[model samples]
Target: MIDGSPLVPHIWFNQSVHFRKGSIMVLKTLQASRVLVVAYPGAADNEAYRKVIGNLEGRTVQEETCKTATQGEVLRMREKYEHSPPDLILGIGGGQVMDSAKMLRVLLENPGKSFANILEGPLAQRSIAYVAVPTTPSTGSEANGTAVIKGSDGVKVPYVTRLMVPDVAILDPSFLSTFSSDQIFTFMGDTFGHAYETMVSKLTNPLIQSIARSIIDLLKLASAELRQTPADARGLDKLMQAGYLGGLATGSVFVGVCHALAHSLEQQKGVAHSSAVLSLTPRCLSWHAETTKDPIYSHLLSEFESIGLQSRVSPDVLAGVDLLLLARQALADPAMKTSPIRMKEQEMMGLINWILKK
Candidate 1:
């Protein structure tokens, strides 16, 4: 059982086993016979996934493919499987797929409740087991309990519950082979943003700080390796491990301005999460550094320089956009509450303008 003032979920990492072997071991350990496999629509026919599914020889498996993790999708999934709930809900893919599975498990456990009920507070502990198999090195949804799903209004909504944490998380480097070097760099930026935000969060404690620091170091190493050899298995493995640690750290301490701004960009402009976060990271860090004398931001900047990572937001990207509205939206985000330094709407606008200018 997870113990402490704040609970941390159990995570597992292995380099030797393939996905097929890993799935079998997890299912056997949970004594699960009926499984609900949730993944991206394209993942269902992938050869790697086919091999993994084939390992469930004697068990019953039902597959669901989702394009995005939305409230409507969660409701539909719950309605489809409510009568015959699976013993295991396995999420395989990136953050969206894993988040869909997490929310699906929430609805399954609640029986007749609507997805909106989650906004009130924490739900009861779910009895259905969940296993997260992340195909991407970003998001770290496998090791985290919070799920960011698109609301009916198209805004991103985050639901948090310790009970939603996955029962198991499997990390395999083979999955990283699918991404190009640029994609890998973007994902690494997301990982670094998570660690940086959490490290500077007001809720951060010694344990969270340690995890965040270690994650930053690992990301630096992975970034360096990927710069030279993008497909290095060992480097990708380190990236995966850093992603997991970053997830766990943020799971407890949460994020601040960077995530808040990125969520707005994602919802309003349909910017990819990693790209938005990466673009805003330098400005957010600069804002924090100006407000406080914390050495962490400076240290992160130096590390970025060492790794040859760029953190400027391009002006052409935000051309013909309403900076005022986006800044207001970001200030309203719940993530803003965790920021070590708070800002008003005007300050947020100033920050947004500064980022655009960089």
Candidate 2:
């Protein structure tokens, strides 16, 4: 057991595993003979990925790129490899790539089942092992069993199964250097929003709350440092750790209104997930403060201020959003059921108006 606990999965941090020799040793340990690599389009050409792939000597490796974690895309991948499934699946990139890998494992295990059917029912035990190597510091998909994939009906669908969690998660800060300053901030926004939502959710227990608070503190420190030096490896590592903790908290207690709204915006409007979270989280916090009288919001506001983030939504960030539609769509999300206070249509509209205020 790592860190004296058997509950947490094995995780390697700030490791020099991107090198050829290290990669070979890691793959050998996993006994990976036939390996399938699912990565983002840009990641296909990344030097880090290239080095790792090159080191997989004497192994049969197949590579696929996923632009989005949609049901259709996952189904296609399943069809392609139906006759001969890989012994191991490695997800290399950000949340979408990782989520694609997690979902693909399910599809491969249960052939001919629709994504909806699989989500609604219990999954068969996963046959293959998945290893997640995140290129970004957001989402922490590598550490959790939840995958949020876009559905065939153009809705964001979340699939959770203990079987979907990766067998291994690798964190390397070198990949973070690829992101620009704006991209870094957008990802940081996601991390912050996730921590906030997890902390304020009604399902939060004492253990979950402690983990959530630690995630927030780490996010605050990492983001503050990144604002000045976007390429700081130590800061990036901190962000990755915080994101991992956020993922644990989310998987443990689940998220609330902010994620519900963000998922809806991403599905309906085709907005980027991080952008949606950045635009909506502050407004969700305000709504909670007004209706629930939760002390978590005030504490979150202070943390946001400390990290140079505004405590309210920025209108410019969501200039063209249709508030009414967003509110209605968000209500359908399962996340709403766990909100600290019940959200009626009137309260939902109020949250929308709060987001729109200049």
Candidate 3:
């Protein structure tokens, strides 16, 4: 265990047993054999997914594959096509696909309504059973309940709340085998961010602390294996599991600056979510140290050293380099909120200047 506890996040790990083993637990959960599988066209073209799709055959099912779907389109699919609130909405891609299912389920639950209303104010609605099957690891859509909806003007708007966590999320290690580490990796930054941010949050508790430690420890082990041998399946599995743990922690406490910067850029500037997050994380970590170093920096330093990043970046330089990276993220980010740490605008600009090197 990284920090000797599972309390950082609340997850039904037992769901994995049922998902992988094809156990009857699924049957018990779904009274109706009918299922709705949603994926982007890209996933539909994937040969690797054929078997899973085939298994769901012979039942009442509706498959939707599209480039993009608006909230209105999702609602119309349900009301017009009579595809009522599905017994289960299975999302088979990254965040966009996952958000589609969540919105679909939400619309179905409240007939004649759509995300427009949900965005207008607080939602009285709760979660309907949505199962998220992640093809890529970084988005963590399976673990969180917030969604970004593109408005009529082609701008994304966010609806943040706790109602977005999927009822079930299935992470298959085999999926990682198909990905080139250089193509798209769930970086170890989340391992540190989730733990450190949660620790720094006013809501930190003994349970959250325990979960954070476990994720950090596991991430260190996984990162080490990847460093030694990039294609290690055993190593990939640990990395995937660590990502899962980070998701659980982030969903509970929510990420701090690294993610906040990503959100600002993606929503306001239309930056690609993965690229935006990857770009901003280091800076936030640097600024974070200036603001918080107690148990937070202590824990972060230990995790980074364990993963072999600390030696490359001495403790003396971590804050400087990380801040430089994060500042570029903010400048490129179309938006951001002043964190609880209260870094001034001038200070933030200074940090940005450091990140935007020639």
Candidate 4:
């Protein structure tokens, strides 16, 4: 809607995406007698959750709260629901919560398969329906099928299955009302990174680029508006819309080096994924520009500067991390497969050095 055709919003999905201020009301209309809600720890106290849950009064609703999504948690969730799987799963939180719900839905339908099993092979088609309700306007998990869960070995493993996309996605700006100032910037950074990376991905095409550019435009408008009015409803709607479009772009193409590095940092140092992405995005953009001498990459870098996005990651926090190992992990990320440059391990190390300005 921001910059593309009217059909642009609905072209990417056969599924329903309710994008409005009070879209949470749509949750009450879903036909499910048995429901499972995988949510953030404090979601029960939130007015949105309370209203939705209250509306589903007669339905048998089970709740599980997760602060972080890990393979262990998914396994535990599977064990809890394997016997009597919910007919519908409502993922009502941020990216991690939605991802947990997606995996849970997959594992429940697949039967006896763990995250390890799915990662090793193709997943069976999703049987049960699930709806995604994202509280944070980041990761675009609500719009995409990819789920990155931390493994037992402390590396995040990405699992992709076409069937993993939610049957419905609800984007309600009211849910974003409680985010702190730090959270606002960090999450917006993630959305920007998705758009930027998609723009430069090897799998990118003209259509995907249009979606990515639209996301960037929406982010710019949202950020500028939010700067003037912290609680601006229009800004929140724009951000949520941008997030969904970014999801469409990333799901169609890929996110390359910035996300690769961010995933490694998240698994290795327990850093916030968005902070790592925010810190690495500008660096990766410049690296791509200098290494490839492409105007596209340089133009992206200029656009990043113009947007005035900033990262909150502390260089001191990364000082203790093993840069060499981090580089190796980044190169090993699935996202790297789509990077414009297929850097060797040593090259990755050099990029890491530049990223840290060391």
For TM-score, the strongest prediction is 4
Candidate with better lDDT, 1 vs 3: 1
**lDDT, ranked from best to worst:** 4, 1, 2, 3
TM-score of each: 0.90, 0.88, 0.74, 0.91
TM-score rank order: 4, 1, 2, 3
Q: Return the number of clashes found in candidate 3.
A: 9
Q: Which candidate ranks first by lDDT, i.e. highest? A: 4
Q: CA lDDT, every prediction?
A: 0.78, 0.75, 0.57, 0.81
Residue-wise C-alpha lDDT for candidate 1, range 246-331, written one tens digit per residue? 77877777899889888888877888888888777877787767667788788887765555557333445565667887888889
Q: Model 3 over residues 1-358: C-alpha lDDT tens digits?
A: 1211222344323234222322212433453466788887767556545545766655677787644546655655666445445566777776677777777776666665566576454454643567777666555566665565566665555555555567777766555556676533434554455565665554456776787788777767767788778867666666656666666665555555555555555544555555555455555565556555655565565555566544332122222234544455544432233133545456666555544541
Model 2, 192-305: lDDT tens digits are 887887776777667777877888888778877887787776678888778777777777567788888887777667778787787677677766677778687877867766
**Residue 125, model 3: Cα distance from true site in angstroms:** 7.1
Q: How far does residue 211 in candidate 3 sit from its true spot (Å)?
A: 2.1
Model 1 spans > 4 angstroms off:
1-30, 119-124, 311-317
**Cα RMSD for candidate 1?**
3.6
Better of 1 and 4 by TM-score: 4
Off by over 4 Å in 2: 1-25, 119-122, 311-313
